[model samples]
Target: MSVHTACPVTTRKTLGQVLVCLGCCCGRTDKGHPPVPVDWLKSEWKRRMLPKKIHLSISGCLGPCDASNVVLILYGQEAIFLGGLHEETHYLALADWATDCDHQGCLVPLPESLEPFRLERFVDEPVAAGAA
Candidate 1:
């Protein structure tokens, strides 16, 4: 039998926001919430909220108790984290917001409907605190 290796999938541009979407998020919260998805992230990312050269990656567990789907946004200078969002629309919104972002790399203001599940910034790991 011949083994077939799938070709590598590559993008054209180096996405402005390189996110780490953690998969297989185990554990539930006090309010009975499940972990975040491979698409979930720290809801308050400044750069990710805007539309720019954004690249969202879905990876493995990001480490923590409360967060399920952890998103790690990365630019050239800094990085950001997000969590607890498991809906498809939210993912789309995040993607749309990550385009044409400002140099400051701040969280793009989102609609009221998508504000509750924002992530708690990891003080130990400062996010996107570098040159915007």
Candidate 2:
């Protein structure tokens, strides 16, 4: 529903990050079928034992309906939006990337293969006052 100016988990140093926004625009069914199975995502994250700093949650909406099922890897003020995530391969890639970032204590470079899935350069919009 609203974009976050800053991540809820604010750390002084950059660490592994994954913002899985199963907003209103996403999940269950758009027209007929489901998108981005949320349960699978949660299970996979736990099974992988991803780093502690890896923040993942379902937000209201992140403003890109055309790019449904958005998953973001945040780094400081910048973020990488990966859209149309409906396959196991995509999740595996995400897990690998997160592990790498955790080890590096910073955002790891995304592979060229994943370049196509990238939605756009994400810049968090300022939150409106007295709207909470």
Candidate 3:
């Protein structure tokens, strides 16, 4: 489930900087139902009229199974992962954050409402995982 697009030659000139990754397993339901929020997110993006530079993608797997419905936002050198977003307010916050980041030239601190959804990527293996 991968789709690639051709970026324009002058991509750097765009101030809209966001890479939204709707990773695999995020939309899965408990009883093998259809995805939860993928369509809704897409609709919100269209409704909000976000910039074209803010690219949206449907990725295969993002290494965090528990954190389904993940959205990866790339601002400057930072990659912010927001998971478990299933509400309209969450979608709105994403747009707001991306717009602010684009104007600010870097990733600003996330709003208080979005703070809990932030996911810290695993850096290293735990020392006590029964590795003996």
Q: Estimate each model's TM-score.
A: 0.47, 0.69, 0.62
lDDT of 1 at 64: 54
TM-score leader: 2
Better of 1 and 2 by lDDT: 2
Once fitted onto the true fold, the runs of candidate 2 whose alpha carbons sit more than 4 angstroms away are: 1-14, 30-34, 121-132
lDDT of 3 by residue, 1-107 (tens): 43456545564444434444444566666634235455665676666565554655657667766776676766554577877776668767877766666567655
RMSD of 3: 6.8
Cα lDDT tens digits for candidate 2, 52-78? 656656566777767776777776667
Model 3, 56: alpha-carbon shift in Å? 2.4
Query: Going through the candidates in order, what is the number of backbone clashes in each?
Result: 25, 2, 1
In candidate 1, which residue ranges exceed 4 Å CA deviation?
Answer: 1-15, 26-52, 100-115, 124-132
Q: Between candidates 2 and 3, name the one with more favorable TM-score.
A: 2
Order of quality (lDDT): 2, 3, 1
Q: Residues 1-26, candidate 1: write the lDDT tens digits.
A: 44456648875654465555444443
RMSD of each: 11.6, 6.5, 6.8
- CA lDDT of each prediction against the hidden true structure: 0.53, 0.69, 0.64
